[model samples]
Target: MNTRVVEIRNPATGAVTGTCQGPTPAGSCPYAGRDGVVPCAGRLVGPAEGDPRCWPVWVPPGCRQCRITFNDQAVACLRAAERYRDQWDAGLHRERERVRALAARKDPRFRGMSDRQLQVTALWRWRLSGPAQGLRHAEQKQRDWGRMYLALAEQQRAATPPVVVGGAA
Candidate 1:
């Protein structure tokens, strides 16, 4: 079966950056151009000039107006968020499994326990803390990083020339 593909390019260097599957030509897919199939036979070309899709994925380094950039500080914050979120999810999953296993045992102590009781037991044993605490910590770190990014963006915007009200007083 024919598959559609979208070729992304870096406008500055005219180099292909990446390609993603586009809609098939059957008119069922949105990304499919006027052509019926998702044009994947050959290398999909980048969008023509003025096409909205030609925009860069990330602002270049040293660009002041960009709210988000691939700077080291921003990248490190993102990595930390991912790591913390993953750890929290894994802990929750392990707690759930432990509760399930405990419930399945025919031991008298667990035999008459309700679902809540089993869950509480698993949580205590796993030392799983409240989600609110974790979320708050992550949010604080994100806010700190966001402030730095915003400051840079504001500085860039201020450096740009302002528009004249009516062609020079």
Candidate 2:
């Protein structure tokens, strides 16, 4: 479906900042037009619950039918975004678990390394066996995960209770 949208751009960089889709040519609603009744003012709304994607929609106090229609359209977009997000999260979780398994399989030679280090090392090991460029994307993913892993590890370490090896000091 061709949804006409106005692209919001950054003034300095001239990059697309965001977009707003509307049902009318004027790019807004709740206005007088050839259709006589343009319904309540429409605008793009989102970063809504369960999704960060926006959708062209109208709010209440106008035609009940129009309001329901707009809301249903918005809900459809949000649901689609939610599904994609769920898949992406699941994939990341699986990848993290796989990395953890790989770390366990390593021998004592890697015993002192942190889990994040082991993950990056594992990626590098794979890179060594293939075309360098082919593993570039995977390497980048590993680096991003490494930073996240380290931050989580730091938080966990800080939250842990100190051990009392013998007796009270």
Candidate 3:
């Protein structure tokens, strides 16, 4: 989120007399603000003071960098979803559990419950409610968008090698 307005300077004085009225962030876009913008020069948070970000940027996309951030976040979300899916799948062996829990139902603790109720007790309760379904949909969309961003960046980078002028990248 470290951002600055693209600067428009005087030709002779080299002084920042005015700011660009164009896009707020001169991103990795080659034509944004006609500044041949690249990624930010400053290191984003999390690394040491000197290192550039190795991970993608994680923010909403108004700027290209923001897209990268969201892409990274999307990938992260997919990984997390996979882990959760694994955990949820662990509870699905219900028939095996019912056979096993049948013996325990004879104990005094099962005094109030019938065999059916005892068998129905879930070891790993997994339910995809409406909100959970919506989240899954959103996550899939984000992951797809993230992949698209990466593909686009790779294509553009191959087609055009960036040139550095006198200003910041």
What Cα-based lDDT does every candidate model obtain?
0.49, 0.42, 0.40
- Per residue, candidate 3 scores C-alpha lDDT tens digits across 1-169 of 2343444333333334443222223323433334433233221111122122232121222333322333344466567656545544444455436544654665554456655655554332323334445545665665566576566644433433222345445
Off by over 4 Å in 3: 1-126, 161-169
TM accuracy, model 3: 0.32
Any residue pairs clashing in model 2, and if so which?
none
Alpha-carbon runs more than 4 Å astray in model 1: 1-72, 106-110, 120-143, 151-160, 163-169
Range of the 10 consecutive residues with the lowest summed lDDT in candidate 3: 41-50
Q: List RMSD in Å for every model shown.
A: 13.8, 21.1, 10.6
Order of candidate numbers by lDDT, starting with the best: 1, 2, 3
Model number with the top TM-score: 1
- TM-score of candidate 1 versus the correct structure, residues matched by position: 0.37
Candidate 3, lDDT over the whole model: 0.40
Lowest-lDDT window of 10 residues in candidate 1? 61-70
Identify the superior model by lDDT, candidate 1 or candidate 3: 1
lDDT of 1 by residue, 1-169 (tens): 1343345444344356566543333323344445433322222232233233322233233322212122334556766767776776677668768667867877666788888888777667555466635654785687578567555544534433333334353
